[model samples]
Target chain A: MHEASIAASLIEIVIDTAEKNKAEKVTKVFVKIGRLAAIEIDSLEFAYDAIKEEYEIIKDSEIIIEDVPITGKCQKCGVTDTYEEMFFACGACGAFEVELLTGEELTITEIEVD
Target chain B: MGMVDVKAKILEKNYSKAAVLRDKFKNTCVLNFVSSPGSGKTSILEKVLVMFKDKYKLAVVEGDQQTTNDADRIEATGVTAYQVNTGRACHLEATDVEKAMAELGYDLDLLIIENVGNLVCPSQFDLGEDAKVIVLSTTEGDDKPIKYPVMFRVGSSFIINKTDLLPYVEFDVDKCIGYAKGVNPELEVFQASCKTGEGLEEIAAYIEGMIAKKKNA
Candidate 1:
């Protein structure tokens, strides 16, 4: 799955940050993954756990992922609504011109290290 | 233990590589074609690409889990083709495209990257394409756009292929477009049937417009 590749990239960033801070060990990696990113949380966790074992610094580190919901603002009505599906029609105006406000993030926000 | 602020995109490395490739492709119109397996991606290329090969410098990078069959088919049409066998990967990465370009070279009017036939993974990976042209055949459910919204949301154009079977199938074109537009209102839609050569001219004209825009830019 692509989650493995994503995990590899996440580890690269984690290791780079840990090394830059001269940390001896990493304990936790905090990440934000949006619903629209189409990532499976369990798969990502599985991949992260499997890949983390390859590095000594982050060998025991746990990945903490925050799942973000899809939210958008209607362009015509200026109404904000959380989208359950991919459809983004404005709930108030019934217009298709809705601007997405979130649900596409794939960021590593912080890490806890010693 | 202390907390360190990282605040980095996970695919930052791939994004940076894609940015480089985008910069290098200033004079080339790169189109990343993506869709589910057996959605007639290579077939569309085999048919539509032939129209442009004689007039412009064009090449294709075919990505698959195995076999160079697609590349061979493209090569048979007289356009240059390179095959990238990912072995286990479900999608093509920016690095894979970079390697393909090394052999295909950067001097060209158009470069079409036929991504691995998975609707899920390729949407996350950018290969320096100017736009992602998504194909959905009528044989598949018309609600595919809603099912695979990430691909539809990120795509610039939507091609409803295998329209020749519309009479035999229950694919509702209007509902499909409505769903797609609900996710992405700006998607340029096209209907095509490779068997009948329907809608090939419009697609070719779209590609020509992209090439001209890139060349003039």
Candidate 2:
């Protein structure tokens, strides 16, 4: 449901990036999404298919969404590591008072256009 | 012929606009209220607006996927209202809120964004709010925070609304409060009922005090 709107934002960013590079139409848009970015990848891809049809430039473009794994830091032992789930508890330090170092990314990195 | 690294934060574009909007709202205190459907957020706002309408220059941006009913209710209470229909979007994003802000004008002392009735996504995205408030009704099971700790953890205040109906429903207030505090110890929790306006006084006072302090500061 929310993926559709996110997809719309993706189309806007990709098109803008392509135009800034003097390209007419976007061929591919690449984005890295954190595993814990709270966005479902399948829904986003489905939304891209449904939403891009409205924009002629992106109608035939491909949306490449990369899954960025969740990473965390331990506040007690000063150890940092990446995990699959959203927990920040340190495996090395066994400290739960850790902070999130990454995994909350939902950005557009590059666009290939022609 | 080969792929080159083009790493960038995808949501940065939205955040850039959201950051500008936050600066614009520096003068006007804003709160993004989140809750499940039937948590009485709209009715609670209605009661609060009537009580503080004259003293506070309040505006509301109603986020619903379809209807303008919430905005209609806000307007009926003499507060300016702008409706942002997400057209199936669950939460109100920064861009959706930015457009509403431009349309609603800037004369307001407080801007309350009533997000779509979902405890999940609304808490995830920040719409440049000074603080996030979660309305927890007595009708819903009291273990909500334990189940949805993320929402309770992020919220600055917990509105335990529908207190007047406590006799009718079997809600464990203490359990919810305990878990909410366990997750985020600094949370300020309040119990209220829009029907009886039982605990709204404190909730209104809390909001009033924050806005007053911000302006006075």
Q: Of the candidates shown, which would achieve the greatest DockQ relative to the real structure?
A: 1
Pick the lDDT winner. 1
User: What is candidate 2's lDDT per residue for B93-159, written digit by digit as tens?
Assistant: 8989889977887777999999999887776576888899999889898888766666775789999
Tell me how candidate 1 scores on lDDT: 0.95
Alpha-carbon RMSD to native, per candidate = 0.7, 3.5
True contacts kept of 1: 0.93
Candidate 2: where are CA atoms >4 Å away? A22-29, A52-64, A74-96, A111-114, B95-99, B146-150, B167-170, B181-186, B196-198
Candidate 1 A-chain TM-score? 0.98
lDDT of 1 by residue, B1-217 (tens): 8999999999999999999999999999999999999999999999888887888999999999999999999999999999999999999999999999999899999999999999999999988999999999999989999999999999999999999999999999999999999889999999999999999889989989999999998
Comparing to the true complex, what docking class would candidate 1 get? Answer: high
Per-residue lDDT tens digits for candidate 2, residues A59-86, read: 8888888888767777788888876534
How many clashes in each structure? 0, 6
Candidate 1 wrongly placed segments (more than 4 Å)? none
lDDT of each: 0.95, 0.80
